[model samples]
Target: MTAYDPIELKRIRWRSRRGLLELDLVLERFFAQRFDSLSPAEIDAYKRILDLPDTDFLDVVNGKADLDDPEEAAIIEILRAV
Candidate 1:
């Protein structure tokens, strides 16, 4: 349950790759700047975020969509910062 898990991180890295160039840039910066500091819950939220389609994901990151899950919302905030 620690922040760092090599296997899960690997999967996260793969999943973070998006079809949208903007999403790719944002996620790249997010990982470079914040990945190591992510809590387990934050990481879980990010995993769910990655499940979103590219346009939906971008919309959420850009604050154009609503998320009822506060955890995912918090992760989107972090992505926005990056």
Candidate 2:
């Protein structure tokens, strides 16, 4: 499996800290639980989603909306549980 470079993981972790508290908390939990095991595909999917506005990102994570790609959708499903 492809591994995230340490710098890349750091960048992702930092970005995951959203302006929205609820989203931030959920993302923190997600990282705590799953960061180590994440597939490179899942990491890339998350990077795409992270480009959304904080509110929009929260909506996606909270399942009130969806992403277009199947990889993104799969990651979002995993996110919902966290």
Candidate 3:
């Protein structure tokens, strides 16, 4: 149960859209732990995005949203990667 740095989380938030860094980190950790058998930080970010409207989410990624939200940017980044 290695502890993840909250400051790193903050930096991730500051540098990325809302919780993108945290979400990416969490997903990476989850897969690493489950498939690689590595103990990593718990990921709880997907829960937030799961409920967001598709248009709002797409708008954020497309840079058409006016909310100036970071989480949207993060979603775009992830979506593009996949």
For residues 19-81, write the lDDT of model 3, one tens digit per residue. 454445544543444413222322223334434565554454455653334553454455434
Candidate closer to the true structure by lDDT (higher is better), 1 or 3: 1
Q: What is the TM-score of candidate 3?
A: 0.32
True-vs-predicted CA distance for residue 26, candidate 3, Å: 19
For model 3, which pairs clash? 17-70, 17-71, 18-70, 18-71
Give lDDT tens digits, candidate 1, residues 1-82: 3747789889889988889999999999998899888898888888988898899989988889968899999988898898
Best by TM-score: 1
- Global lDDT of model 3: 0.42
TM-score of each: 0.92, 0.91, 0.32
lDDT of 2 by residue, 1-82 (tens): 3567779988999988888899888888888887678888889988898899999888888778988899989888888987
Residue 79, candidate 3: Cα error in Å is 1.4
Ordered list by TM-score, greatest first: 1, 2, 3
**Which consecutive 10 residues in model 1 have the weakest lDDT in total?**
1-10
- Global local distance difference test of model 2: 0.86
* Candidate 3, position 11, lDDT: 48
Candidate 2 vs. true structure, TM-score: 0.91
